[model samples]
Target: MKKIKLYRPIENFNKNCSYEILVNGKKMTDLKNGEEKVIGISNELGKLNLRAKIQWCGSEKLLISESNNIEVIKVTGNKFLNRQMPFAGGLFPLTGIVIFSGNSELFKNIGIGILILLLLGLIGTLTIWKSRWLKVIRE
Candidate 1:
């Protein structure tokens, strides 16, 4: 048996929501924003499947071995990604439009367009994009 440290830094803008940790398709524990938790893993299991749940199909699965002393796994999500459906959906586009429209004339068309696209792409990670809302990495 071994131990793993799961951490979620404060950089995630969606502070209100917490991530549910899963080990080998079984739920282990949950971690709030800026929180860390230590959990036991079975060495016998070998090549365990580790993942975090944001809401739905949260993140990509991570394959890890239990031979390490203590693996520090970090999970993170993009900013402005904790939006609720229907309501927050409309608000996001409106908010983007407002910001784009309010920008200076010099950067209105090109700069604002690029900024809006970037933000939309990031937000899409939670939905249509191939990437997930949360990213899992080892430190």
Candidate 2:
């Protein structure tokens, strides 16, 4: 038998929320804030699946590994960039467009075009963020 420990520290996001633990897509237990649990697994060597979900918000985080013994599974909510970058990137270009509109005619068009391109890039980043097509790299 293999044993693994799963722990979640009390954080602002998940401090008061109940976390549902799943291993290999099976319900393990409900963990409260600052709780830890040890789970046993079979000796088979395959992909080990781990997931955690906040009960109230239904937000989830997942981690998969080839090793059987995992020390901790931190449940992180949506990242700041994932939530705010869309608005920031989208709005920043408008300011430039307004500021440069009164400049020389040729320069004004160039500025507006550049700002439009930035808006397009913002839209593309937002699309990727919403669909979750890009994988988040955790340090």
Candidate 3:
């Protein structure tokens, strides 16, 4: 991922300022005034010089005005998942369990209810894993 270091020259305007980081004129994040501490971008965006603006200012240090048309620099780096293994070992056992359960006859004579329960559990686990991985990437 690329690392962009931005310095906001304006200070004491209020902690509640609405800041935006725009890459080549595209908006990335709309953060709370206080939340405007530091920002990072993915490597896909490459080295970018962004235009930032303080869109709003609120009462107290918690309230600050937005910045406009400010230029910032970005440094390029390796891809975010470059260090990830091509084959993740953690998914093997789960895959085996899913494949094994598809042949229901192996668990026959035990009762349809038991098989249904096992299938439901496997489905739930896969759903959770998928959602969790998606969340990690999104952040």
Best by lDDT: 1
Give the TM-scores of the predictions, in the order they appear. 0.64, 0.46, 0.28
Clash count for candidate 3 is 16
Instruction: Point out where model 2 deviates above 4 Å.
Output: 44-46, 56-70, 76-139
What are the RMSD figures for all models against the true structure? 6.5, 6.2, 15.9
Candidate 1's residue-wise lDDT over 18-111, tens digit each? Answer: 8889998899999998999999987887789898886675788998875768989999984445443324545555555655776467545555
Q: For residues 35-123, what per-residue lDDT tens digits would candidate 3 score against the true structure? A: 32345555454444454444321111111113333323321111221124223444545545654666676544344545455566556
Model 1 scores worst on lDDT over the 10 consecutive residues at 78-87
Q: Which structure is stronger by lDDT: 1 or 3?
A: 1
Comparing 1 and 2 on lDDT, the stronger one = 1
Q: How far is candidate 3 from the true structure (C-alpha RMSD, Å)?
A: 15.9
